[model samples]
Structure formats: structure tokens, C-alpha cells
Target chain A: MSESAAPGIDTAFPLSPEMRAAIIAHARREAPRECCGIIAGRDGAPVRVYPTTNIAEGNRFYEIDPKELADLEFRELPNENAEIVAIYHSHPASPAYPSRTDVELAFWPEAVYLICSLEDPDKPYIRGFTIRDGQIAEVTLPA
Target chain B: MASESTVQVLIPTPLRRFTDGESRVEVSGATVGDALDALEARFPGIDERVRDDSGQIRRFVNLFVNGQNVRDRDGIATPLSPGDELGIIPAMAGGSAA
Candidate 1:
């Protein structure tokens, strides 16, 4: 059977403008340190950007905020149109790229991983990725 | 005495131009805060990116020592040892709708 013909299979898609703005704003607000959040969308268009605190608190590394993640997951069940399409984070002190842990933790093959670097503050660099089982591939961000 | 561990402090892209494209820099410090201080001292003007106007750590940025968040351990006082890598990631916001 073809991949598309398989049952119980789901495919993830891209991000949208509103979602993009939310991530960017969060980054700017948290300038200097990295900020991270989630994006929900359907059919390749991002619908919402749920901002979450790094909870790394003052740490330079990023771990998804447990409360925020729980809240998002809760919200997802109610909103049929919303599904996690991307997981975004910023590199306040680094580049718009993934580190070793980033690669290792990315288990969602269908979800896009978005990263932004706030080195410039005025002009942050954003990049997208597809990480699956230790493999990494670059994805296109919405212009 | 300070711990004998040495790790590479990764600098962000925007600041890389100032550091001459240096992505990872080697520094020796016992704590995460100390290593950050060393980074700023060497880079100059880089501290502005990590701290707010009042000199406190900005809310959006996160510093990770060995995949663990500094906030859970000791904030800036998180200890570090040799072979530990520091990942500095910033929070980002997109353009406004209005």
C-alpha cells in the first residue's frame, strides 16, 4: 500500500503569518535570552502562536514550559482546526540553527521546527527545519 | 577554587559579525554567570544582548548548560565543568498584524 493510503497516518504542514508574528514578538520581548513557543495550524497554514516562557528561567538553554505545553495540549483538543505544526525557539546568543540536543529531541517527523536568532535585535534571523529520528532537513518559512 | 572544566560558549549570529564570525568560543568559568561575564568582557558590547536596561537577565532569553536549564539549577550561578557546552537561545516575535 502507498504511504498516503496507509490508515491512522497523519501529515503535518507549514506555518502562517499570525503565528510567525507571535513567535517574533516573543523573541523581541525576551531579547538577549532565548524564547520558545508553539504554533498550531492546518493544511500548511499556521493559525496561532502560543507564547510560552522558556522556564529555563535565566538559563541560556530552552526547555518547553510545562504549564504552557499542558495548556496548549488542552487547547488543542477543543480546537479541531488547530494542531501543532511547528515548535519554535530563538537563539538569543547563537545563530538560527539547531544544536546537538535540538537534533536529538526532535522526534516529530511531520512538524516543522522553527528557530530564530536575536543577535541583531532589530533584524532577527529565522530558519525552519524538519527533524526526525536524528536526521535534519531545512524547511521554508513563510515570507 | 574554580572548577577545571572548559567549555565553548556559543555566540549568536547577530553578534557573530562583531566576533568576526566566531560561532563557538572557548572560555573558562566555574558558573554560567561567570562564563557569560567572560564572554561579554571578551566581546564588549555583547552584554547588552543578554541583559535588560536594568542589568537583569531578560525574560525571553534562556541559557542551557549541558542540556539543563540554568533557572532550575541556580540561574546564573549554575556550575559548569570541563566538556560542558553552553547553548544560548533567544526568544523571537514576528511582525504585527496591525
Candidate 2:
């Protein structure tokens, strides 16, 4: 029930080069199908990117396996004093922007949404945003 | 019939607002549905977020009892035991292309 206080212009999605590379690698590895994951963070900065299974049954959508998400949210991240700061998914062949489906299914308003686009195959574009109350606002993904 | 048992429900961060910031709360219920009803009794409007208008568990909202999905068991009818743990996990779903 989080309201419209989605992270705005000030909040920084500091994705490290290594983590960025890992996401791109996951996207490429998953290929035609979409890849999904979450970034664990502490104090508002990203610490790790965990590649999760996309159990959506097709390539056009992604749904992180509930078991994995529960483990992270309930056990893993808590022990580290970290939380999921960002959620990432691959577009496969579309641009690095949130599609209508992404906006609609975004229930976690606190976590920044990162979309990695493999439109060109060779060049994967990654962008970050916050979707809350059906409104989308781009957030800076500090390279 | 099993008596109502007190169990711990884990409230994820996203739903913590409705829980008044309490990550975990103890509720007594014979089944998952009863526990949720008890939760809603304490935190108004939270049940709607987990269940649809027909009172069915939402597609994207997953309820797990001690790491086991309730859907795999008896769904909302899944019985609870004393000190059982229920986890409400909002599925992280969606994709960029269409």
C-alpha cells in the first residue's frame, strides 16, 4: 500500500560497472526469453545483483520465482542488513524502457525498476525508473 | 477439529505501511484465511491487497507457510500450527517488451 512517493530525481541508483556487466550478461545469457533479478542494497546503494528465474512461461514477460523472492526477502537480505533496492528485467528485443506491462505489474514502489534492453544484441541498454500508483519516473542509474 | 493456533506472519517491506511498520505479527487462526482475516482485523485494508474481490488470493501475491507455498498445499485453506510462519511475498513480475 505504498503511495506515490516513488524515488524521484534525487534518488540515485548507483549500479556498479561490475553489477551492470553482470545484468547485461544475464540478459544475454537468457537470450530470447526474458531474465529477471533483484539488487540487494544497504543504505540506499546497490551491493549485489541476484539473477532470478523468470517463471512467466514465455519470453515476453518475467516473473521472479516466488520461492527465490521469499528466500531473499525473508532470509538472505535481512541477515545482511540489506534489502532489495532495485528490480531488473530484460526486454529481449525492445528498447530500454518500461513497457505497459511492466508499469502495471510493478507492485514494489520502493524498489527502483531497471530494464535491460537487448534490442541490438551487441549493445544492451539499461535504464532505471520508479513506478508507483501507475506513474513512471526515470531515476538516474549512476554508471 | 484443530484449535486456533498462534502463528507469526512475516510482512514484507512493501506491505509494512499497512502493518504500521511491524515486519512480523502474531495472529491466531485455524487456517491461512483465518490468520489473514485476523491480520486485516488489526490492519485495515491490507487484506484487499492480498485477496481479490472474490476473496481469492491474488495471482501475483504468494502466501508461503514456513518456506512452502500454500498453493501447493491447500491454498487459503492450508491449516496452521502453533508458531507457524506465513510469508506474504508479492511476486516480482513484469517485463519491458510488451
Candidate 3:
């Protein structure tokens, strides 16, 4: 399928263990409140994980800082010839799934959405999905 | 009066569908609003995603000129310079389970 074949859903992209560990670590550090970040990739594969600030008013939601996003898009990513392959956020007390609010705010239809659930602090569960036009489809991750 | 200037608007990933998969587009305007108007004229249906019904920049969309946020400047009224870079970035946001 073409890159834009399905909009925001990469049907064949896989994640690395290091990257998964990074996300899990971030979720643990920001426990009780949501943590969020970006997975930068080059040539359809991940190269870096940017642990971004969650600027929302409360723990129930997450909004990345605009300045950090600007720098990543205009400078870092361009310099590295990388793009945002996925966007990951944590759910301190919920399941590893897209919430109703997540589906509603999933504006980047081309980005894989990764959700890390800290519901079981001892075993953080991570899952991936693609949300477009208020629809959600699960994507198997961590290959 | 300042002359209208040509600037490049960087289209983020999500809005690329409206921009024909283009990452950057050139437009002319004296201010950010004018540039946005030109962009919409060239690529229909994009204005609504970036701005609200009231013509205000959507709360979740960030408009930056030369890496400086318009919100920190003069909002839509932020002035543009020749060869300036404007970026339309959708805020990365979401929440937990239902």
C-alpha cells in the first residue's frame, strides 16, 4: 500500500526494543500524570525517541509543547532526514488503548499512536493504533 | 506601508493531504493572516483545519514564523518578511482510556 494509502496508519512498520523501553521508562517517570513524546524515524524506521513535555492542565490529557515541536520539525528532523513515525503517550491509570479523547484529538492521521498503560505499574503494557476520522485500528508493535 | 513579502509555509504531516503531499509551499502576504488566506486560496479546505469558524487560530494548532510562535508575537497579525518560514504544526495531543 502507498504511504498515504490509509492515512496515519503504517501497516508494516515495526518498533525496536530500545525504543519501547524508552517509552516505558518515560511513563514510569511521569506516573499518575500522562507522559507524551515522538518517535522520529528515517526511511520508515525509528532512530530517536523524543520524550516531550505534557502541557495539559491535568493528568487525564496530554499536549506537547509547541516550541519543542517546532524545533523538532524545523531543525532536528530536517537535519537528520527523519520524520515523526509515531506519537506515544502514557495512561497512568487507564488501559493501553486510545481513549475517547484520544480519538477525537488524533489530528495527525498519518502518525502511529502508541499508548503505554501504567495501570499495572509492575508491568507497563504498550499498544499501538492508528486513529483517523474518529476510527481506530490496532497495529501490532515492538518487533 | 510595508510591501507584501514572499514566504514559505511548511505543511506538517497531517495537512499534507490538502497540500498534495507537499511539505513546503510558497505564498505572499504582508502578515500571517494574508499568507494563510493565500494558502487557502491555493489549497481549498485547509483553512478550516488551521483556523476556527471565528477565523481564530485553532487552540491546538500552532503557527510559527521563523521558529517563533505567532501566539508569542501578534497572533494572526504577525508580520512576514521576504523568505520568512512559516510552519503550520498540529499540536500532538490525546488522553487515556474511555
Interface quality of candidate 1 as DockQ: 0.02
Indicate the residue-level lDDT of B96 in model 2. 59
Candidate 1 CAPRI assessment class: incorrect
Better of 1 and 3 by lDDT: 3
- Among these predictions, the greatest TM-score belongs to 2
The parts of candidate 3 lying over 4 Å away from their true place are A1-9
Model 3 Cα lDDT, one tens digit per residue, B17-85: 788889899999999999999999999999999999999999899999999999999999999999999
Q: What residue pairs clash in candidate 3, if any at all?
A: A8-A109, A8-A110
| All DockQ scores | 0.02, 0.77, 0.71
Clashing pairs in 2: none
Ten residues in sequence with the least summed lDDT for candidate 1 chain A: A1-10
Residue-level error in angstroms, candidate 2, position B34: 0.3
What would the TM-score be for candidate 1 when compared with the true structure?
0.51
Q: Kindly list the per-residue Cα lDDT of model 2 for residues A1-143, writing each as its tens digit.
A: 35433344225677889999999999999989999999998877678889998899878989999999999999999999988888999999899888999988998988889899999988898999888878888888776
Question: Per-prediction RMSD in angstroms?
Answer: 15.2, 1.9, 2.1
Clashes of 2: 0
Error of 2 at A17 (Å): 0.7
